[model samples]
Target: MTNAIEFIHVKKEYQEQDVIEDLNLSIRKGELFVLVGESGSGKTTTLKMINRLEKLTDGEIFVNGKDSQAVSDRKLRKDIGYVLQQIALFPTMTVAQNISVIPEMKKMPKSEIKKLTYELLSKVGLKPEDYWKRMPNELSGGEQQRIGILRAVIAQPSIILMDEPFSALDPLSRKQLQDLVLNIHEKFDTTIVFVTHDMNEALKLGDRIAIMSKGKVLQVATPEQIAQNPANDFVRDFFKASLVKNIYDVYIGRVGMVQGYITEKPNQKSMLVDSQETMRAVFKILSKYEYVAVQEGKEILGYLSRQQVISYLSEHEKD
Candidate 1:
């Protein structure tokens, strides 16, 4: 399948310093591609380039096989949705009005826009009746964040760009929004390019990750591949820190932790857990059951015992 977004030898320089250098990437249709890096790594700049919010200094970017530069800026932007770190809601506008901004700008029918606004609110886990008339100040930080997402998705854009959209929320709210985004992605099948400095968040949400540093992509691979086989010393140290913290984010809820234990019986005694849940949560579950089920969303991926959980934790501690 052709990529929904592609960057070829893309470079961005300002005053003789390259913010992004000779970058190449391809994000497949309907896949979540995450970019992770330290501060000043240019992840945000690269994302801006995709939506033409930032002009590329050199090379090319393509969206759905069409040259991005060839498209009219307004039309191109209208085809891509963007959610930024700041929840840029219009304070004077109600939730429904804020969400309808894009569609209204597109000259959509009033009735159609109203219907779509309600649908988008529901999609972002908000009830229309409760949230529609509320202003930004009346909503919680998390609720505002959801409104930001709803505004972006209201247009049914083919691709979405998220720049640390959950970074400003509390941990509990962040987790809720993360799961909400994943659920929406699955239902809508929209290609997403998400940017974060949080390694755990990147691993949990990304289908593939691109690790960047000093304006260059250091590694691009599945979370498992990056964890098990780091491409370089920096990558190795990255996982090392995660391991020391007992946050094996990449492999937290993946299959094959306990071999030959997955069963197919419906209503089987099992524990339900989020893929992004901590290993400590797994241990707590194991404390109660001989074999506790592991899960990624609603799908079961076999079971592990108390002994296995303890043993795995011990071994990782040694590392």
Candidate 2:
């Protein structure tokens, strides 16, 4: 697949410190690429540079095969949709009006823009009659966020940039929005660059993840690869903090859900958990059955309940 975005020897500096240095990365067309790291790691900064929101201090960035530096900033931004942590919706405008803002600016026909706005709202899981005339304050955080995304997608941008778009929501709300984003990706196949500090979010959403520190990309790989083989001690220690043991064993393997066996259907609910995944994930699975099947490639094994998992942890704890 052709690269939708590429950073070649990209460098960014601020005053006395470098925010990103010699970063080389490529996001394939229609893939969700996540950038993850501790605060101040330059992940967000790197994202902004793609749309010319942040000027590069050094190096080259190409979007759809054209150098970002050479493209008109306004045109480049128009072709990319951006959503941030705080959803800044217009208080006075109705949902339809808000979503139609960009298209209106481009002088699209009012009737066509309204049609597009309604379509986008529906795509984002909102009913047109209920939400069209409602003010931003009338909606919940999640609803407002969906509107923000609807606004972005209505522009029909080929790529989208999201910087912690769900970070401000409650847990349930965040999960709903995350699932919504994934569903949208499946349908639209737009290239997405998602930035977050949450490792679980990165693992769940990224087709490929870029780990950054001190303004540099340390490694870029699939979630499974990063867990199994970290590039260096920093990467290893980072995964360790997440409580991942045998990263390769966990991510690359499939665990059959007990329900699957009973239903005579393939298990799709199983997930790979790093040592860092909350006890909640394991507990959730255990609540339904006593045994879960684990697999790597064609090799399959079974794991027991909390007691068994804990006992396994304890035995390995001594090591």
Give lDDT per model, in order. 0.83, 0.77
Per-residue lDDT over 1-319 for candidate 2, one digit per residue giving the tens place of the 0 to 100 score: 9999999999888895788888889999999999998899999999999998898898999999999999798888887989999899999999898999887887889989988887777776788988889999999989999999888877678999999999787655776688888987888899999999877778889999999888888989999999899999988777665444432123211222321222222344444333223343555665665544444445444443445554544543443
Residue pairs with backbone atoms closer than 3 Å in model 2 (clashes)? 19-215, 20-215, 242-276, 243-275, 243-276, 244-275
Model 2: per-residue Cα lDDT at residue 201: 77
lDDT of 1 by residue, 244-273 (tens): 663443244532453344465435365666
Once model 2 is optimally superposed onto the true structure by TM-score, how far is the C-alpha of residue 40 displaced, in angstroms?
0.8
How many clashes in each structure?
0, 6
Model 1 has how many clashing residue pairs?
Answer: 0
Q: List the candidate 2 regions with Cα displacement exceeding 4 Å.
A: 243-319
